[model samples]
Target: MNLSFSKLFFVLAFVFGLFAVMVIAKSVLIPLSMALLVSFILFPVVQKLEAWGVNRLLAAFLSLLMMFLILTGFLTLFSTQIMNFSDQIAGFTGKIMDTLSEVIVYINGNINFIEDLNREELIEEGISWLQASSGTLLQSTFSTTATLFTGIFTTIIFTFLILIYRDGLTKAFVSFGEVENQDRIFRMLQKIQRVGKQYLSGMFILILILGFANSIGLLLIGIDNPFLFGFLAALLSIVPFVGTTIGAVIPVLYAFMSSDSLWVPVAVVIWFWAIQVIESNFLNPKIVGSSLNVNALVAILSLLVGAAVWGVAGMILFLPFASILKVICEEFDQLKPIAMLISNDISGDEKKAAKNSMWIEKVKGWFK
Candidate 1:
């Protein structure tokens, strides 16, 4: 009984400690998380520039400039479309309300078996809740926006400093007093660098493919702001599971609102569905491989927990961070069990099977 009680107490304490860490991470760790993600994304470009005979500092600066320009250009190009989409929300809400009313009327007229549905009461309650929550929600949104802006600024500064002094940083990590410790640190850094570069590069390629596919589909379906929708889709695709679905809803809803025919929205949905299926089954395996090997369930859970902890930034950073943890765990024999639990190694044959499956799919795709 004493041992059982102690174990229970320990579990409860651990849970509370995790919650406290998450809360503290929102303010204290978010910027550093963002910085790490940015650094990972930029690392490959800097390395490529270095390979082409540029100095590390110059290469890093150029890579940073390029990233900033790309971001600025995307925002500039899509600003009007985003504004228009936001402006149409009131109309969309009204239309959805009307649709709900029509559905309720249809149900009441057709099914006399269930008369007391209380649709009106439900609608009223929903509206009342929305009204009550809107002010607080808006205030919370603005606060979050301010925090995000500050975090981004800090991340940018941190990323620039890290990149500028990357060589010195590496040297410092590798110059520990003990040779074994120095070697271990250097190896760890190398592993992290390789994993980070591969993850970022694979993600970039996947996003680019998704963006182009989405744009073409939207265009073919006669959507108004195809480019903007594609951009949004690409951005959201960084997040796992729900991201693609959320991305689809925007374009489909836009189609519903703008187009007179219901078929447009239906087509948009089908298009997104097909694209997502292809991405999941084919593209992801080809691009990302089983190197980072995080399990889908863990990835989704990490995304949710990260979002809860640090909002969108956390959601964006969570997967790679989790992947890094898995890598670290895998590198140490004592921690390999935990790594296996988190990784996509359910059958122990995952790596070999994934490679074979990827090649098969690639061959099929090429022939088709």
Candidate 2:
């Protein structure tokens, strides 16, 4: 009875802790999480430099410098395009309204399966809603901007410290164990490093390939500011499910508005679809397969939960953290069940066994 009560209390405490985390995510957790993620991503690069006979501090500095330069270059190149895009949003909004109106008219005229749809009122309501929430939206935007800067500052500091003392950190973990357990801990650390590095590197490669492909495709289709649109798509590709659609929408909408050609957007869609198909089936399997091993459902759910707790930054950091958690769980025998649930490693035999078990259970229940 005491043991059971203790277990119940532990579970309740865990739930309460999770609730507290969700409530204070932005102020307390987000910056630290972002920092850890950035550090993990950059750790491999620093190690490579160290292998090349560079001092750890200098290697980390160089790696961080390269990252900063790349970020600055991207920002410099894209700033003007972003400003122009922002300026054109009002025009885009008008065009969208016009397009919606045309669609409603077409639908009303053709699909008369007892058409009682109040399309005009719906559109008006949407416009009204946008206007009504404009102030709150602006306030939210500024607040987010402030939070972003703070997170960036904290992340930079954390990443630098982590990189500088990565070896020490590993040794510290090892020190917590007996000599035999020290080896195990060291091996786990190495595995974590390998997995984290591979995941980040694979993602970077995928992003670049997709970005370049998008830019070239957009240029071929005569889309203005193809590079900008492509870069936007590439960045959004960091987000699952919605990234490709969001990326495709801008170019397609621009094509519609600029050339007034429906075929252009349709062609662009086809091109994006082809690219996505290739990436999913071929490139992703070759590059990222079996490394993170997170199931699609779990990834999506984690992303949603992260977003709800912290927003876009949460979505970006959630997957890698989840992958790390899975790795940690897998490393310990007691936590293997949790690891299995997190992993995408359901063998055919296991699947068949599970199916048969389900069927047997159902048969027994029916008989009873």
Candidate 3:
């Protein structure tokens, strides 16, 4: 009992210690991690340019420039939509408040078990509170926007430098391992980069498909700015489990606030739920593939722990790294079990089938 407890205590201590370090260094680490993952996606572009006889410096510059342009395009689209719709959104305030007041009044009238509730008084209190805090809210929004832009700039700079020195970085990492194990370490790095590249590329394609699908559905439902809202929801889907619901909620709330009929919001909800079903079962597996192969429990745990350690950036970054961690763990006997634990748990028959599979080893050999 004592021995088992001792081992467990040390393991927990190590985990907590890592978390403490992550939290303390998050401001630096978040941008660096973002840059690293992005570089993985961009690495192939850089390589292709060089192979085609482009200057090394020019190749890197062009790759970064392309990335910058793409990102700028997305931001411009979102900002334009938000700017144009801001007034319309404000116009919904009265309608939403009135609807809420009606609901509360109906509840108070019907639910005799509860005391009489003054919906008007409650609405007045809420409006007054908002008025009082408007300045603070504006200040918070400004600060958050500034922080976001600053982080983006830092990540871009880091990504450029990483692309310029990727080879050196790979060598440095390999050198940290024993000479006999150096090749294995290099292979692991390649695997990580491959997984990162494939995952990001797949996510981009999936988002495009989803955005188009959502827009078509929303347009059929007679929603205005369907494309804008569709792409917004699609972008949110990048963050995995929590993001999907949030993506759905914004449009659904807009439907409720803007339409008199409950069915509009209900239709929005049903559409998103159907998208989720199709996305999970068909689109994601086909596009994203099972490269990450993280189990639900581990994926959710990673998101929670990452969010605690590094906020939204952590939530976005950690899942792919968890996949990378599984790769690293697979290189060692002691850690292979952990890799399995992180992976999607399979039934015995499935496991047997995987063990019997020959192509996996063949693919790994090609990399070697």
Candidate 4:
């Protein structure tokens, strides 16, 4: 019993130490994590280019350029929508404030929460605060934007370096294992790369499908700028359980503030509720979840742990890391149970179908 307790304490200490290192090195790791995923997505292209006798450096550079152009195009579309949103933001804010005043009045009448409430004074004070903080707000925005670009730049460089030195890295990893296990280690590395590639490709398809589905539903409901809201919501849905709620809430809030009929927001809620059902039951399990093969329990645990450790970036990186972890655990007899626990409990035909994914392969075909 004492031996068991000692072993448990050691395991706990090891886990905590691992997490501490991750938190401390996040600035470097986040970019590297992003690059590792990106490299997997780009690796096939690199291989094809090499097959065509293209120089390795040139191939890596070209792949980065292609990635940059794709990102820039999406950014251009999003920026145009941002401009449109900015134009109407003042009216939207006013409507939201008006709705808040009505709610306050209702609560004051029913609950007698406060003796007197002056919303106008509150608004005036809020505006005064904003006016005073405008310079600080502007500086913060500029800094955030700069950091975003810098992070992107760093990710690109790391990706290029990873691609360039992939051979060396593979050997380094394989060398860590015994001679009898080196071949298995090499294959494990390949599986890790495939997991990253497949997860990302599944995500791209999932987002596109969700964006169009959301936009169509909103258009049917006669919501303004349905595409913008739909796509923005779809983008947020990348974060998992919490993301779905946030994505839906944004549009629901807009409907509440802007539409005259209370029924409009109700209908918006109904649509998103239906979307949540379909996505959780059908789309996600078949698409993204299949790629990760992570059970909901493990996925949620990782999401919470990642959020606690590395914020938004952790949330994004850790799911794939979990998948990679499963791959690693499967190699050890004692650890295979950990892999089993992390994995979805599908078997036979279901497991085979998950392994035989067409999603990422279909996405990859577009590059050719």
Query: Model 2 misses residue 9 by how many Å?
Result: 5.6
Score each candidate by Cα lDDT: 0.79, 0.78, 0.85, 0.86
In model 3, residue pairs whose N, Cα or C atoms come closer than 3 Å (at least 3 residues apart or on different chains), thus clashing, are none
| Residue lDDT tens for model 4, 50-142 | 999999999999999998898788778778777876787777866665666777767877888877767786566656776899899999999
**Model 3, range 95-122, lDDT digits (tens) per residue?**
7677777787787788854576788886
- Assess candidate 2 and give its lDDT: 0.78
Pick by lDDT: 3 or 4, better one: 4
User: What digit string (tens of lDDT, one per residue) describes model 1 on residues 132-199?
Assistant: 99999999999988977887888888888888787798898788536767767677887877777787
Q: Lowest-scoring 10 consecutive residues by lDDT in candidate 4?
A: 358-367
Residues 182-282 of candidate 2 have per-residue lDDT tens digits of 88888887777777778777878888898899999989998877889987887787776667678778787787786776899898888888888887788
TM-score of decoy 1: 0.76
- Candidate 1 Cα errors over 4 Å, as ranges: 1-19, 44-61, 83-97, 100-141, 165-178, 289-291, 346-368
Give the TM-score of each candidate. 0.76, 0.78, 0.88, 0.89
Error of 1 at 307 (Å): 3.3
Question: Candidate 1: worst 10 consecutive residues by lDDT?
Answer: 359-368
